[model samples]
Target chain A: MSATNRQIRLAARPVGEVDPEDWEHCAGPVDEPGPGRFAGRTRAISLDPAMRGWLDDRPSYLPPVGIGEVMRAGSVIEVTASDHPDFQPGDHVVGTFGVQEYVVSDGRGAMKIDTSLAPPSTYLGALGMPGMTAYFGLLDVGALKDGETVVVSGAAGAVGTIAGQIAKAKGCRVVGIAGGPEKCAMLTDELGFDAAIDYRADDVRKALRRHAPDGIDVYFDNVGGDILDAALTRLAMHARVVVCGAISQYNNDTPVKGPSNYLSLLVRRARMEGFVVFDYADRYAQAARDIAAWIADGRIKVKEHIVQGSVDDFPETLQMLFRGENVGKLVLELV
Target chain B: MSATNRQIRLAARPVGEVDPEDWEHCAGPVDEPGPGRFAGRTRAISLDPAMRGWLDDRPSYLPPVGIGEVMRAGSVIEVTASDHPDFQPGDHVVGTFGVQEYVVSDGRGAMKIDTSLAPPSTYLGALGMPGMTAYFGLLDVGALKDGETVVVSGAAGAVGTIAGQIAKAKGCRVVGIAGGPEKCAMLTDELGFDAAIDYRADDVRKALRRHAPDGIDVYFDNVGGDILDAALTRLAMHARVVVCGAISQYNNDTPVKGPSNYLSLLVRRARMEGFVVFDYADRYAQAARDIAAWIADGRIKVKEHIVQGSVDDFPETLQMLFRGENVGKLVLELV
Candidate 1:
């Protein structure tokens, strides 16, 4: 079986905003499935802030993507060719398949998605990596308990939306901090959040004080900047600040804005910890099952901000995250 | 018994250095032992940096010492009179008996000390609160393991000296930071520390880099500020910074200089935690036994910087800590 694949490769590392010249579109013929590998047609791609970190050459959790390698991404693909024992052709699969029209993998870190339950992009968003990040970050790392108040920044983004829902399901009073009124309304109305702070209009610290009268027990910080400083002020005793992502300072020309009010941790006996989704790999099965059950019960809302585009449009699609233009999850549907 | 008891009372809170005007000496009649009470004559008073935190009118783990109350101090006292069956007249005891020549207590939070094994002064200095703070802070809070590198600030002081010894005893490489060359020499030569960084004479970060090239696994910080900043830059993965005290910033008229490099906690997956000694009250028996055993075997050296003075000299005794004039555990022996 011959499959033509259109791939987006990193031409150069971006300076600030990723320029169009930074990515090059390359087309090639996809080969037959190897002894253990399978070939699939790509459907939707996931855009994440960690994608920016993977581009910079520094000692981080992961190495930088090489210039010649296909731009790293998590995507949903339709399985068309398979020779491995675990899978068959026509099965819907999801994994880190890069920015390509077709993907061939050796069944490592790949999950079979039943679109009959949720859409293909949903597996790439709410039920996948970002979902797992929010789950473990708030519940395990943050040590969230019932009746505790949770305040999540980037409340309308992929991780924040899922985190709020998970905390709400766990019987927590959840408050969300989002940029616009629309996103704020979406957090409170669409998701089961107790309160939403419009950070664009209201003062973050004052909003936190009003919403969390007893102070926040858990702070799920995705956009770390002045907002993180604002949250630091209202942390209660034994509060946990989960550092899932720092979107606010990822593209900073200078150093990231260090939280000046960190002494609050000492005063409140609080803790701030960071986590990567890879650590939760062994427990994903249980988490995915729980999330799927929650979705089936209409307890969690799945929001996918899908952009219909070709492989060359990958760089532009990623910019949507930095600009805060995408709602729930930003996905590039290969055309 | 008509004992002429001299008690140091807090006259006023000081703005910077504690002055004689801040304290008032009262010559009062010795409190007689009532039913189920014991009257003890103070032998040695434990002068600790934590005594400063008790003077502040802010909320902490314990209630602040009131304006006209006797200054709180841990003391080794010999019971001169007893109406309680649990304690005898000749029994040596360790308890928070205030800065006074005589004390009367109902035997709560008071542990009987045996002078047959060690000196009564050792109960207030080494085998006492400072020793317990060092043991628990280094082992429990710091989670120290064998073969790891331990860096301690205020290395010549009571808690620091014991912490360094305990880390060394656990088969760890220990580095200490002290004010002068003499204290540095005492730390390495006398206290069994692997290396000593004289903060007054050498660059602390440079010394740490040279000594603990693999990065510090645990840092017990007593003298916070730039020393804490230096230690922050050298933390290994999952490093624990035990906030035993911050004496360096205690008497500052200005706000404490916070360590700006604290984000190293995130980069290294480290933590900084504060705890009051009272939190481990139930485990003091375990600590005293272990520390006394270590001292007996010469695994830990017991050093007491005893200042022979009356209760009226309490203000001047407290100032020695801020001035860094005393080494090991500073205690006031009533003369």
Candidate 2:
């Protein structure tokens, strides 16, 4: 076991795109697990677009990560010591364990994840919070019907990839909008998406008109901006726009562009709804079971882009999400 | 009957606030009703903020009022001649009869209204399209619950007045935001609202915090823009915002200012839904019945600002709505 813990702390609130100056590296003596607590080493840390929203000093689903504090993150940790009833040494757990080498927890929001069925990193990706977000956001918030037509933005990213695949699994026509030709090809060729539009190479509105000629019934929007406005123009009657995340706008110095064509909701009798994955805490286990079954049956493929690095690599790893550099789930695997 | 019918034709599309030149007063030969059709004399024409939206050349719930065409309007009329089975002379009816002294229709989308229950002008105000807009926009689109905190903007206008009363009747705590002290006072004292905020005099966000300290559960928005941003900031968990109209933005030559604080929707796990009243065509009868019962029981009050004038007075009468000069439902009663 390591004698010291290395951690990344928020040095300042990000103005627009996060800079290296916004983070600080720190070292501290490792503490033993106290009574009714467990100590664990982080094996993998999640790098999500949602993390950008947390860096802003504004009201959100979660409180902003305060300056000089350990940066808040979702990570898979392997228990090294335990003085709690629920946890034992060698058990793998998933929780909001900050960007650090070691963590001590009282088992408040932690759940033991089985590593035999899938690797520890899968718990931080498809089998974890992102997976739950895609499942509930599409099924409950989006109110997706079986034969509905779905269009997903940021379709090569974590939640989008899972959401599109799940829509396909439900017998819906799924169209994905990703940044590049390779990412777009991966969506149609590997992820079972019916059509994929390379947003970088084509005019998204015209491409959408070609691919979804009937109009989008369920729009799972992860990247908001002009693309959202285009999607608004092509909404079918009673369309459901699921506001998952706005990766495209999160790094903007200016205000987030509200969809100018949002009034389309009135013409189509449609609705746009926003939700947080934590709101579906009670349903996570059931969703996990279903997702696990799909993976076992080869219906839903698990996609991860794991970066082998130390805790100091988190800042650059996170920037990759905003740059549209990584595909599927992007995570940092502590070596 | 007069030798010619007096009519108002659209001379040009309004740039910002509508001008007198946008309308041209003309006299035309009154056509006789053909087989299965009816002819009627206009008694009262409804003046609405929605009319401003119809003048802009954009895709909306309804088509733009084309230049050189008879201006589209809703009016109460008395059947002067009929060959249709559903109507006869002396019957008062309500329909889209345009801005003309006389109308000929094929009995489609026209309803015979009983003046004995309410005045003929009431069919152009509280008991007509405005009433139906309030009914479904609140209960259905806003998903209003009995004990919820409801806040309404443009609280003294046609749909706003009706929507506030309906929310109050549903056992919800209602707060209204209006432009002037008189309109604000009418909301509380006459419309049975729990509180009223004078947006012209006081800061709306501060007033909303005072009135809805628990945050707004349902927001019935008519005058969108800054007020919509304020409402977004004060949303309670799982709140619903019904986007009925945006009278404030309809006259602007610049692009509409999208709400900068719309990310609040994600923070509160809330939704903002837009709806056009015409979509509930099948349920209008049921809604009208309930509204009539409420009016008879004294739970809902009828408020109308009637201008005694000829058809040529439409340009100025319509301007009254944009200037916020009219108290409740604005209508032109030809004298």
Q: A73 in model 2: Cα distance from truth in Å?
A: 0.8
What are the candidates' individual DockQ scores? 0.22, 0.68
Candidate achieving the largest TM-score: 2
Task: Please write out the lDDT profile of model 1 over residues A131-185, one tens digit for every residue.
Answer: 8988888888888999899999998999999999999999999999998989988
Top candidate on lDDT is 2
Could you give candidate 2's per-residue lDDT for residues A1-335 as a string of tens digits? Answer: 55789999999988999999999999987889999999999999999999998888877788889999999999999999999999999999999999999999999999998899999888988899889989999999999999899999999999988999999999999999999999998999999999999988889999999999999999999988888888989999889999888888999998788877766777788888999999899989999999989889888899999999999999999999999999989999999
Q: Name every residue pair that clashes in candidate 1.
A: none
List, residue by residue over B1-335, the lDDT tens digit for candidate 2: 55699999999988888989889899999999989999989999999999988888887778898988899999989999999999999999999999999999998889999999898778887789999999999999999999899999988999889999999899999999998989988888888999999889999999999999999999999987889889999999999988888888888888776766667877899998988898888998899899999999999999999999999999999988888999889999987
Task: Name model 1 segments beyond 4 Å from true.
Answer: A1-42, A66-70, A78-92, A100-107, A199-217, A224-239, A253-270, A310-325, B1-41, B78-92, B100-106, B146-148, B199-216, B223-239, B248-272, B311-313
**Per-residue lDDT for B154 in model 2?**
89
Best by DockQ: 2
